[model samples]
Target: MTTDVIVVGGGHNGLTCAAYLAAAGLKVTVLERRIVVGGAAVTEEFHPGFRNSVASYTVSLLNPKVIRDLELPRHGLKVVERKMANFLPLDGDHFFVGEGRTQAETARFSQKDAERLPAYWDRLDAIADVLRELVIQTPPNLVEGGLKEAIPELIKSAVIGRKLSRLDLTAKRDLLALFSQSAGDWLDGWFESDPIKAAYGFDGVVGNYASPYTPGSAYVLLHHVFGEVNGKKGAWGHAVGGMGAISGAMAACCRERGVQIRTDTAVAEVLTEKGRATGVVTASGETLKARAVVSNLHPQLLFQKLVGPGVQPADFVERIARYRSGSATFRMNVALSDLPRFTVAPEPGDHMTGGIIIAPTMAYMERAYDDARVHGWSKAPIVEMLIPSTLDDSLAPAGRHVASLFCQHVAPELPGGRSWDDCRDEVADLMIATVEKHAPGFAASVLGRQVLSPLDLERTFGLVNGDIMHGRLSLDQLFSARPVLGAGDYRTPVKGLYQCGAGTHPGGGVTGAPGHNAAAEILRDVRRRRI
Candidate 1:
């Protein structure tokens, strides 16, 4: 009935936070509304025989410190380093962007471009080194006069401020442009190859309705690029046994550390006494007490629903109301009898290890975005595909494979009156048909399929409007501006309560930086109290 901390939402970040707190010897309990422990990063059996990671398919951004600190592998977490990352099918043969042979294979398409690849990669490494500073540190508040006033509240605001002020003019300008300019424009400035540009550009719009040409897209690209797989920078890789394996490992680690986990237990409200959180009330009329409560829900869902009205500042409540989480996404899982053969180039085998990006050029990507803008759905949307079975034998029957397709331009809440139930099947067909163009027998090879739209995503995982990162990963909604301006730190408006989820600093992706940073902040406050 009582504990030192009650963590709401059994997502990976929540699990990580709980495990760390438990490691610190605090009594912790995690309450998950779903029957399963994994939140979005889950693996499920959509068909009787086929199971695949339903929401989050890859694992490149999870902080290594968490893994090392928790010794997750000791608790049944095994990360199979994806030997291959992505294979983009083009025309029929395809171009690849993952590990080993794909690099040289990509070079074969354009020798000059190939020769420049290392330099390009090296530069990204250097830039990522600078951007890496951001991964650990909280984003600098951009509020006007914010530099002065917000400083007093920051734990290391001065340190981050000095690092930021140290940026050379061109680097500063370029960094600003990278965060503000569309990924298409930014990549266009870097390369001439349509495939390379498209490959990188796809990341910029992964969770957004905006086109690759939209401003602030390059930031997404950069943020995504900071992640590594098997210790390789800017590379993407799959979890060994569907995404759920990672979550399961985290949960196991939490349990190993003596953290109590309660699945299917929903929090109806955060019970506060004189404006300080003391515990939570379950929807089932059971009250569990805790010294502090942490919510992984979106700020809107937190204050608006759980915190109750009048608990937050009116301005904060209004800002939470305005938080945008409309993601134009649709997810699909298919059981395939045979590997898809594409018309692009050297076929899909060698390149399939990497993600398959259907966008061939910035122009092509923009037109796809424009389709959603005008038609409310892409006539030819951008599709990113990964066959985890190609690397992980556990996802499908022997020789059988599962393909997880992430499609864009299908608006979460589409313009006009269209809902997902009516458009779900249609969206799945469009994605398959697109793949069919590249791989002639892709549709026929599919034995069964599971389609999830933004509505389904929101409904299933409590993801705000189905926006996976708690809310949109936009500049306005990121950093101190995240969820709400002037509240970027883990600390909420309510004293003693803190946030440690994707809604906090550094925004979304599998990165555990937010959880780590939040805990440090809380521990600091606790230490001060002891003093």
Candidate 2:
């Protein structure tokens, strides 16, 4: 059957795009390869009776506009902010941020650093506010075509310039530094304490596989803070029913708008007619037709694997070939018999209801990255543990709990022809042991565990080499140059084909801004009969 548009994946962004398109009175259909909807944002029971958000576990970056537009809350999507934002149990000392006392927490390391905290936040919030405004708008595409194309592209650039012009001279300088400097360098200028810098620098390497000293990493640090939870700026939280609830709500909103969703139906190829996307050919050898086709897959997967050869220009193909992707990420979820008892703060309190970070200082974070560059994984990996079950009891049974371990600095591809499957258990044990060092009983408390190596993430979620941001968030690969330079406004080199995933503008983190912006552009084209 033919439809107005066919979405090639059922990721949260795909569901989001479909919801918006259908709500605009277009007929949309979504096909998902998995049994469920939420691409990587799914929650599942890896150990029987213990369900947790498998991939995109935490919530803070989901766009609030998407929440209100989709009526997520009415559809049973709820998020509870963490009582405390982060807990860093160090060697004989500890650091805590959020849940108030932020100044007090910083003062524990250095009084001067405590005094500088407000100015740091003021500068950060100013730059973050500018990015917040830019996230939902389509970036200009300056390459390809003639003077006709150049005119509109120039107009779009001016519009963005007008927005950036609102920033004061100091804020503009701050923006330039963040976009160009290393997270370590930037933090070194602001705070003199290792603990304070480490606590804040962790954001620089969340999905990034780089060192805190990597240039352009401060922008990654800023990327994580441009989001809010429940109207509180920069506050992280847990979804009531795990991350799946966010996508479940999006799927419901799409269905409510009369969109058809088919699960376990993978599209094998994107069909084109004289260079325009017509529809797709499913893995089952069934052909489906649509006026326009939207891909929510990573740009690499969509262009390299799905679209047939010779359909794209040689220059564009070369540029896409050069598009860097991969991450040093390894994800795990453990079923716990009891909560972790920390050595620094053994007694349970507000700290238990937030993120627990294992890497102590900037030196430790750098060593983890350097070690992973040589060995397949870090001897002392960087780990962030979130006991979402503390706030949402629905994840585990009775008194038991579940924890998501987002470990980093594991090479995306193991060295010397070693396979992750061969050493996954060994690596997982080392990670648990790392946590065990901080929280003595952590290893014994694990009833069972589920691990996703970088390769495993690629095999399971179509995140090429497991780069969760779709591509590295470096300066050359973000905003108008994302995916490619000539195709940043959701439209592709091929007509009637579009991208609405993390690979596009505002890059990654379940923000749904790419989907929201892509839909707006798609609707505009549809209204103009261009697709």
Candidate 3:
């Protein structure tokens, strides 16, 4: 069997990439290992009558350009912004950060911090704008080029530099700090309130195993805000039919463009001949050929497993081996009898609609990470609860609700040689208990539950070490340095092979920027007859 392009992994990004290629008149085929496509961004019925976003919950970073180009709304994709942004229930009190209430809310904790909040947001937004431009554009290769071929990329770099140059000294410094400083230190400079800092600091540690004090964590925070929902910058929304709706819509677009999709067809290995990717071999030994191959798999998985040994340069192989992955993520979905009643908020209102964060202070977040480093899991983990059912009623039975509990600080590889299968229910209980402490009777409200530990995440969704962003979004592994320097442009050393996954530039999330950008580069190469 043969095609123009074979996208190995029908994740949202793969589908997005195939859609673009097909739109350009290429005959594209997407191969997915799972019974259903969408990869981690799928909604499944975990409980009898409750459906929830199994891996990736909520929507924030999905690229608006992808949405506009794919005409997602026409394919039944609707993202409804949460009435609130975040709700932090501290000791005996609560804090809310939303569209209009942030200033007033911060004032209740520290008036000075309240005054600084707007500036902090403005500064972050400025930096985000600079990053937003780079999302769809290919990262300029760091390797020096000859005079002729280097001109275009050099100009692109200059334009990016000019954008950065527009910032004032302080904003410039803040931008630098965001790229290098710890989230704790960065937030400490702007806010005095721990809850306020915690509220903002949570972004720094999402899907990151490190503490808020970890260097380069501030960039992770920035990565989360680089998206907008319904034109509202830094806002997150719930897809009406869960995260699958986003992928489903992408698949609809792909199919409309004549891209062939085959699920439950696992590719065992990438077939290569003479240092160029020719196609793939399925687990069932079916060989499929393509003019060019694109991988939407995590880098380590692609290089270490599928591509395997002796196919690429040893140095390149070593770097791929060293690529950092795995996080403290533990996902839980529950069929709730009723909504959680917070000790502070004590009601099912705007606070319930937004992300209900359990990490109250920066120190607490750091301690959680510290404990996980030593004991394999935090005694008190950070939890982000989202009751998507509040906005989308179709997910649950009548009057019943479903809640997504995204917890962290559990080691991907447990200590004492413990397996996740042995401790899955135990960790799930701990997560429930932790939430119950804040929202009394919360555990009692659970009608049924589904848990995905880091191990489960890797085994189920093929998330290497369960790192949702593919690899760590650290400075050394980001931008032109991502998944190693030479391959950061989405082009591997092996010709005819390209990467369009979260492992590539712009990192992860439901955002299809990596796919869109990779497709752009692939199209350019194909048009130039370079591939």
Candidate 4:
């Protein structure tokens, strides 16, 4: 069978790309390996009668352009903002961070830090505004293009430069520091309170395996705040149905535009001839041809595994091999008999609905990373607990709830040659015990629990090393350098082949910018017959 374009991987990004390409009057077909789509952003019933967003639990950074273009809301995609943004429970004292409570919350810890909080936020917001402009853009090539090929890009670069030039000296300095400095050091310079610093520093290490003191981690912090949920900048929310609803809606939009979607069809190989992607061969030995191919798989899986060896330049192959995908994420979903009662809060309130962060101090957060660096997993790990059931009752039965536990700082490759399969339950138990420290009855509340170790993530979701961002968001691997150099614009060295995944520019977190931007580039090339 032949089509205008073949999108391998039917994940959210692939679906988004297909939707846009089909809207442009292309005959697009999406092939997915899994029985259901959505990739990492899926909601499934691990326990009977309880459905939880198994992998990606929260919604933020989903591009508004995607929502507008796909008419996602019309397809039953609704994102409800959490009443509170975050809740940090300390010993006998707690800090609740929300739109109106930051100042007061910080004041409870340190007046000096409290006074600096608003200014700090102002500077961060200024920098975030600058980053917001970059997210939608296809990253410009670092090397100068030929005069004929470069003029349009030069104009776009100038527009971006003009936007950056508009920033004041202070904002520029802050942006540089954020892009270069360690998250711990950056937070330390602005705040004296450990709780205050921890609250802010936690963003730096969400999916990262590195410590808060790791250089380039500040960029990860900035990467997260460049999102909005329901028009609230940097806010996170629960998708109405689950994270799957986002991809499900995108699939509906694609189908509406006459795009063919084939689930349970895995592409065994990307069929390339003479340095050009022709189409893909299914695992079951079926061949499908296309004018162009857009891969939503991680770069390692796409190039090293599917495309196989000796196709690309040896140097490029080595670069892909060196692409860092270190992650420390262990995800869990628990069917709760009842809501957890926090030792500090003791009742169901705004904190229960918001993100409950267990990393109370910067030192504690660092120690969690330190342990993972030394051993395999952190004995006392950083846990970000979200009880989405507090807001959305559709996930569970009457009075029963589901909680998504996103834990971090466990080594992707454990020491002593131990497999994740051997230690998965142990890690899950430790994570539950860590939560039970603050929320006393948390362990008892688990009617059933589903755990996904880092290995499970890599095996199930095709996340190389289980890095949730697909590739690490380190300075050497971000923006134009993402996945590898010379491929940031979603076009690979292999002609007629493009990448549209979390491994691409702007990087990860349910943001469809990669897919949306890749489609724009693919469409541009298609018009010029470049494919």
The superposed Cα distance between candidate 3 and the true structure at residue 425, in angstroms, equals: 0.9
- lDDT (CA) per prediction: 0.79, 0.92, 0.91, 0.90
**Better lDDT candidate (1, 2):** 2
Error of 4 at 340 (Å): 0.4
The estimated TM-scores of all candidates read: 0.93, 0.99, 0.98, 0.98
Tens-place lDDT per residue, model 3, 1-531, is 989999999999999999999999999999999999999999999999999999999998999999999999999999999999999889999889898898998998899998998788888888888779888888877655587767867887888788778888988888899999999899998888888899989999999999999999999988888888988888899999999999999999999999999999999999899888999999999999999999999998888888857878898999998999987899999999888888888867988889999999999999999999898889999999999999999999988999999999989898899898999898899999999999999999999999898988998988988899999999999988888986788988788999999999899899999899999999999999986
TM-score of 1: 0.93
The all-Cα superposition gives candidate 4 an RMSD in Å to the true structure of 1.1
Assess the local accuracy of residue 235 in candidate 3 as a C-alpha lDDT between 0 and 100: 89
Off by over 4 Å in 2: none
Query: How well is each residue in 1-531 modelled by candidate 4, as lDDT tens digits?
Result: 999999999889999999999999999999999999889989898899999898988988998888999999999899999999999989888989888987898898899999998899889999899889888888876544588777766777788899899899999999899999989999989999988888889999999888899998999888989989988888889998789889889989999999999999999999989888898999999999999999999999999888857668888899999999967899999999999998989988888889999999978988999999888999889999998988898999999999999998899999999999999999999999999999898899899999999899998999988889998998888888887877778988788999999999888799999999999999999888897
The candidate 2 region of ten consecutive residues with least summed lDDT is 140-149
Q: Which residue segments of model 4 deviate by more than 4 Å?
A: 142-145
lDDT of 1 by residue, 1-531 (tens): 889889888888888888888888889999999999878888998876788999988888887777788787787766666566666666534566665554586676667667777766765566676767777666544343555555655646677666667666756767777768888888777767777777778888888878888888888888787887666676667787788988899898888899999998999989988778889999999999987888877777788889966677788878888888866788889999988877664354546665778877678778887888777678888888888888888888888889999888766677778887888898889999998888888899999999888889888988777787788878888877876776787777776677888888888877777777777766766667720
User: Model 3 off-target regions past 4 Å?
Assistant: 144-149
TM-score of candidate 2 to 2 decimals: 0.99
| Backbone clashes under 3 angstroms, per model | 21, 0, 0, 0
**Tens digit of lDDT per residue, candidate 2, span 1-531?**
899999999999999899999999999999999999999999999998999999998888999999999999999899999999999999998999885677898998899999999999999998888889889889988666789768877988899899899899999999999999999999999999998899999999888989999999999999999999999989999999899999999999999999999999999999999999999999999999999999999988898899876889888888988998877889999999999999899998889888899988999999999999999889999999999999999999999999999998898888899999998999999999999998898899999999999989999999888888889999999999998887889988888999999999988888889999999999989887898
Screening candidate 2 with a backbone cut-off below 3 angstroms (N, C-alpha, C), the clashing residue pairs are: none
